[model samples]
Target chain A: MEILSSFIKNPRKTTYGGEDNDEKIIFLLRKSVIVNINWVTVAFILLLLPLFVSPPLSKLTYMGMRVINPGFILALNLFWYIFTIGFIFQNFLAWYFDVLMVTNKKVIDIDQSCTDVSETTLSNVQDVSSKVKGTWGVVLDIGDIFIQTSAEQREFEFLDVSNPSKVRDEIADLVAKIKKRNGS
Target chain B: MVPNLPIRQLVIAGKIIVILIMVLYAVFAFILTKRVKLMNANLTTPQSKLFERIARIHMVLSIFVIILATINL
Candidate 1:
């Protein structure tokens, strides 16, 4: 359920931040494109490579040590497996938690990599734009969103998000409503 | 001729190094667990509970593995 769960009854669900009075979530987005996990996938491949080449590698270990205990090697393998599993678990959590939330009043971007968060209020928004570049972005329908605001923070970007145009339009519409309400 | 090292001495030394490394990893895992808890408290969002659950499981499993290694290896 990335951004606006159309399937569920309570469609607008966000992982972080609470809704204010009459403030509702428009969408909750994860980083766009499945390619974001390429590094982790490569790591998995590397982890499994030792298994395939163990026969030759074991010979090398025997030559160096002159007495390689099978039991010791088995224990080491178990340790490595556990360590690798923990590494993968942490990476997945980081990917899953990194979120961009669009609410009626504001947009909240949370970067799980460093746990940094930035927000842009609709009242302060001056311009909204989204870009879908590169072959992968065009083919997969994933892109980045940019918001220019009057506040000190100025620009807020939601990087690598899916359906950037739709997100941009939704934010633009909300900003217009806010402007109209203020008689501006 | 290369002098033959005592295999028992070498094995014990390797195990000690492994234990030291595992201890360091255990500390790192504990710190990560605490960080997740802190983030959950600050955000208190709908998915915070889910995140907390996963964090707890990861921390528990990590510690359990360390204990297993300590006892067996």
Candidate 2:
């Protein structure tokens, strides 16, 4: 599934922003590589914890130092495994759905978590810039994209995304086209 | 040999409480699934579909786990 939906530079037929007519997606991006690496690290730790703890726990139970029934202990271990897997998947869902999209007409930033959704759209972009700071960001080609527009709200920021330079150039190109079309 | 009456009663009550907790969790999962559905309706991205599928599977599996706990544990 990750392979199938892995980030596309220019995806086709996406209705993520809405079914509005005449809007074509130019770029689709997820958060920076660092964010995903963090998730992977946490999941790996969770996966290994049972292996480290189960032996000592079982040994203690065997020595009659623990009052827990063996069957109950087994069930609890199974429950822990299920919970761990579920927790990992929930994190993936959050990461996968949180997106920064650039279309011909607007730039949409979506931040989705388990219980909340915050989205912003900017249609009147005046300037665009991207920065790749810090050792990790520069080494990994990841940073933030900032879009300044005529909207009353704050500048639309694509926070912690990969290939910020390329994203900025794409948005700049789109803005140029929009300006040319508007004859402004 | 018969088990002690109070112990048996306590076990039954414990099981009932667990079952109630499971039912409440199932409801919570159901509400989450509904929210995912609503979110999916507005966006037609591959990630959204995958998220919706994960949420639905989580909800179903949670119910099954609850049933297993009720019956076997």
Candidate 3:
């Protein structure tokens, strides 16, 4: 009973905090991954080429009908495997790196990279300007958020998150609350 | 029949192109890794560590590709 109580009382430290918070903890206003669907499509097409070419080459080599070395075929397979793996890894990193989080006190852009860099800016809420751009962007439901500030910084642009309208409304609401609290 | 292209010449040309690309990839990876390191120095986070691991893998693959291309050439 004592062990259970301690465990409940002091939860272990975690790398990422939960979405829901009781003490005025605001949900993450926006999340996005940096993948242009077009680029992914291009990479997929390139990776598929080897699959079509490999089988015939392998068969020819096995039958000893072709002068080509078996080792060359193996090398090609290895190269394709490496290329595919690299492509996936690059895409994953791009997605992981691109994120924007909004809380009651501030807006945080956690740009994931080997070098950890986070940019946090306090919001006025009143100056939030949201814009959705491009035909594909509109169709996909992903666009940029422009947060205009009275400060010297000018503006903060949150790029390529799904459902821009919802994120805008949430930010507007938070800003209203903040203004109401500060009597501004 | 048209004169056949020497297999050796074809392989050598392909190898040169592959090596050039691998070298370019390595250069970009190194620059990216340095940028990541600078960011990590400023802020320590689990996400940063994950990025470092990914960069390391990219670097290793770049080296391997270069070596393989050299061998084939």
Candidate 4:
């Protein structure tokens, strides 16, 4: 379930504020978890660094005076590890909370700020396009979907979303269905 | 050039600085937990409660570390 959160289709028992009681989320798009590998790797390296770092400092001599106190090392390591944990949590939240979801009624883009939410009705959708860039994106099936709309925001972009073409088609289908229902 | 201060003084100063930084971080962790709660209210997922619990635990962990630093540093 955790792994599936990044790109969930027809999510069950999921809801956002202001949703109608019967409203259903069709696609819940968060940035691909693969994107976090860079920072995760950095955090892993940082966690292991103190072991390699303190030994060299303890052996170092500066003008016949030892450079770093060995006793302070443990506290320093604790500080460093906590800081890294904060870094990991921060990045994870930025990715998790910033969501682009398509529902039966509208498309909502929740920005990284966690407080801002922008949305447009399906009936207002004018165009939908999907693009996959780079080898990794194509291989990993990660891409962006661009939605042209007549609403106030005009465009809603879902970035680093998994399976862009599928989402775009589903959105396009919903828009067409709404247009037919409205006879627009 | 490295200052030739006594090792004990340097350790004490380092501990104080680390504590100050950690205190600021504790404040940030508090803000983060608040924000996480706000987000959960906005978007209630199947995992919302779980994530909210995780955020609170992180906040507590940060405060606990600060206490440990005070005791051990």
What are the candidates' interface root-mean-square deviations? 3.9, 4.4, 6.8, 2.9
Candidate 4, A60-156: lDDT as tens digits: 6656766555554655676677778778878887888889888888899998766999988888889999999999998999999999999889899
Worst 10 residues of 1 chain A by lDDT: A3-12
Per-prediction TM-score to the true structure, in the order listed: 0.78, 0.77, 0.64, 0.85
Q: What is the TM-score of chain A alone in each candidate?
A: 0.75, 0.81, 0.66, 0.83
Candidate 1 lDDT by residue in tens digits, B1-73: 7666576677667777876777777677778778777666534456666766766776676666666656655
Note the residue pairs that clash in candidate 4. none
In model 2, which runs have C-alpha deviations exceeding 4 angstroms?
A: A1-7, A55-71, A114-123, B1-28, B47-49
Off-target runs (Cα >4 Å) in candidate 4 are A2-4, A54-75, A182-184, B1-4
Please provide, for model 3 over A1-184, each residue's C-alpha lDDT reduced to its tens digit, 9 standing for 90 to 100: 3211201111222122322343232434323433356667878887888889888766752223343446556655666666666666566555544445555565545555524333343544347767778997778777778877665556667777677777777677777787677677
Against the reference, the lDDT scores of all candidates come to 0.67, 0.67, 0.58, 0.81
Ranking by TM-score: 4, 1, 2, 3
Residue-pair clashes per prediction, in order, are 1, 0, 3, 0
**Per-model RMSD to reference:** 3.9, 4.8, 8.0, 3.2
Q: Between which residue pairs do clashes occur in model 2?
A: none
A94 Cα displacement, candidate 1 (Å):
2.2
lDDT of 2 by residue, A65-164 (tens): 4433355445445555655666676666567667767767667776664233333343477789999889988888888888887777558776777788
Interface RMSD of 4: 2.9
Measured with C-alpha atoms, the lDDT of residue A4 in candidate 3 is: 14
